[model samples]
Target: MSKIIDTAHVFFFVVGLEVRQEFAHGALRDTSRARLAVIAGVASVALPALVYVLVVGAAGAEGIEGWGAVVGTDTAFMLGALAIVGPRLSGQLRVFLLTLTVVDDFLAVSIIGIFYSEEIRIVPLLVALACLLALWLLGRSRQWSAAPYVLIVLGLWLATLSSGVHASLAGMIAGLLIPAYPTRRHKVVAARQLFRDFWQSPSASSARAVGRGLSRGVSVNERLHEYLRLPTALLAVPIFALANAGVDLRGGLLVDSLGSPVTWGVVAGLVLGKLLGIGLATLLAVRLGAGRLPEGVGMGSVFGGAALSGIGFTVSLLIIGLAFGTTSDLGRQATLGVFVAMVLACVLGWAIFKVAARRWGEETADLPMTLEPPVDPEVDHIRGPEDAQLTLVEFVDFECPFCAHATGSWEDLHERFGDDLRYVVRHLPHHPHGPIAARAAEAAANQGMFWPWLDFVFTRQHALERDNLVDYAVELGLDVETFTEDLDSAEVAKRVERDAASAADSGAHATPTFFVEGCRLLGSYDARTLTAMLESSRRGTRTQEIPA
Candidate 1:
């Protein structure tokens, strides 16, 4: 099973490489091409997402049992592959593909949060917001060390995971915020000299010239670029695949599960929807004057690549895990769907690329120059000892399904424990709502109605857009004028940033993370598990009071 998972990882890497190469070639030459690719990716993602929203919402499965089968594209596995392959093909093409993939990731994350999530915990969301601010602020002037920023990034992932947002959303958010340019003058000088050499002698030695440019002096931003392009993409993604994709398929049960409606839905959505969405969107982009044909590539090649977008492996599988419980028929079906889609995508994508390569002669272009920006660390605040005892620490995001679950659980705790529990909220913003949601949470906190606002979020986690957050504040009878302004205020942003940093330092990478009396738990929990822990903590507290 592990071997099969590993093979699947390699398979995805290849698929990602092919798709990226296609996008990169298009992106460098024409902005329209990149835009089209983005459109196709989003269109493909929307197919499943829409299905989830409509079917699940109508069925009232918006609760824990229902939203378990929502499917999404795995951006990291796909885009990370592009990053690893580097801009070696055509620089313009690579840029186009990279940008498209980045946008794809961002959109997918947003959909998960805004439409699919459950509830928000104000404190955790605030914490996540603070972290985002810190990352932006510390890295804003581009004066921070890469180590602290890296730690901050990881911490955000952990806290976001704990907070109830998809942990992967943290990865994307952090990636976007982390600068990717030369920070030092010496590095810039060396890079320019190397670029000059490449332009001067195109035929002399491309590989050596590029290597020299990459090896130029160290910049925190450049190092970050390397981290994203290399370890995160090539190593972490593949390892994650090996861990997550291995399913025991030998059982006849596995085969039978694939025949179910849920499986069909996932498979059809990924396979059929991807092709239709991507292909149609590409055509529309061209018609709308948003995209154009690449110099050598034609509509046929685009269609073929569009078909490849059908390969919804990682993200699809993850959604399956969340939308469908692991033990259910839905999960089994989703797993099969992912495998079928990947296989189909790989074959079709390869065929299309082969034809395009032969016909167009595969002539590549060079990468465009990118200006380096300053990088920062989004860190959480340190907790005091008194705040530690009986402290209910929750790291969460406003837009996260699991966070919603945690929010539900926390509400239960707050009701049951009442004043006994001192809640400490931390931000672990993930995906579409990370930064935006955090800001909203902070704004609500400013009005002294943070708890009620959190309850409102839990009730409408799926509706955490900027407008929705503002509306929520209004519904809560807050000073809408002040609340709206606070949502974007630097002070609020900073407070959220502080909490986010605290979450990172605490090693949270998933949404709805909890530390009850120093015991940590990740992901959502049932009432029984949480009650048991609370009971245990209560017992311990009582025993300590007995003066042992």
Candidate 2:
């Protein structure tokens, strides 16, 4: 039982949460993409289940109870193959397909929890629930350390394993409980001020401190996920595959198993079911007004992508373990069915994509030189004279790499412009830590020391832990207790949220976006290029010097 539980636990801990986080992230939104993601997940599951039933009944495999084996899309194989075609695909199309896979993962895992588990022990089950409650409180408290959370989850995993519930469910539950918002969020003035301070001082300790502050800006769940991605791919997946993928194809057993009903059922369900399920559901979603096709993507492209979705590899092997006895000949043939179906699916998908691309290829246009984003100095954190003719507003996430590039020149812009430029900082925390940086800045603003805090954040953009934030506050001579309290205040959170809403209004979807005199700017700009841009904006002349 211990060995059995450990295998699935490791798989879910690594592979499961990786997919779950993406679904949870998209599902949190109510927009069309989110709705489409949800509908796609349901459709992926339902259509495959329907197909499995028909194939099983027709093949006389109804007694086998291996129906769940055909219901999941192989996330890794499908995505890897699709990436080769991504150059010809729109960014939106790639996003939807990835999201669709995430939804399918949730469906597959849910089936394991519901249908594959054995008899349960009530006491250990209660213990697992208690562990979950403790984990929730840890996230709510914003502890920001991984050690305690890891310990708690291990306990949860153990309890879950002993309770007869699959231990993989523990990892999924822990992932869902990670706090979505930062303690306070962004600190524009504090970040800028810290950057200036660091430039003036240039000490190793402050650089290290600032690095941590920047890292702290990322939320616990997102940070954990990113850190785990490499290990999950390198260690967990390969090991799981090695253990479960070893099927004895040596005997006349291969010929005999191929003749079995389960083999035919699995092969048919994965190849045929995925194509019809994903393609038809997307069409239905668009027709019902629940979703829209990705821009420049037509029905041909949709069908092609749907065909690609049929390439189920890693995930299919996992279902084989859960739904069938691995030692049995039936399981061996089912595994063979998966491998064969995947090859056929890949070939079919590629052929469809070639025809679709040739027929419906849309010409890509050059990006615009600049766009117009909302520029309200009244709502932004302004540094420099508010009446200055050149007001540059930056929509930033402290955790974003491009924002770090832009942070260096912001303080110097003031020196160059003197009283002629009004620099406004708007919070758009697309990064998980964005909210933390925002809140830290707002809390400092309440203390009349926003610039110093903002400078600290920018200087240490790589290090934004709770302890680090507190240390920075103490270093800046603010009341540490008050600053900490304000970091968690509802008012501080609302202030940052207000900036996010404004960002949406202004069409600033991506981070490090800027607006000069209501005209938007992208990418990192040096001192010389910025001077040219300001002059162009001031003169009301559109220059092609900057690419869109």
Query: Evaluated with TM-score, which candidate comes out highest?
Result: 2
Residue 3 in candidate 1 has what lDDT? Answer: 36
Which tens-of-lDDT digit does each residue in 480-546 have in candidate 1? 9999899889999888777666555554545666665544543335555666666777778421110
Candidate whose lDDT is highest: 2
- What do the candidate models score in CA lDDT, each in turn? 0.56, 0.68
The digit string of per-residue lDDT tens for model 2 on 395-495 reads 77777655623446675666677888877777888777777878888898899887667776776777877787888899899988999999999999998
> What lDDT is obtained when candidate 1 is compared to the true structure?
0.56
After best superposition, candidate 1 residue 217: deviation in angstroms?
6.3
The C-alpha stretches of model 2 lying farther than 4 A from their native spots are 1-30, 61-64, 85-95, 182-212, 293-305, 362-508, 514-548
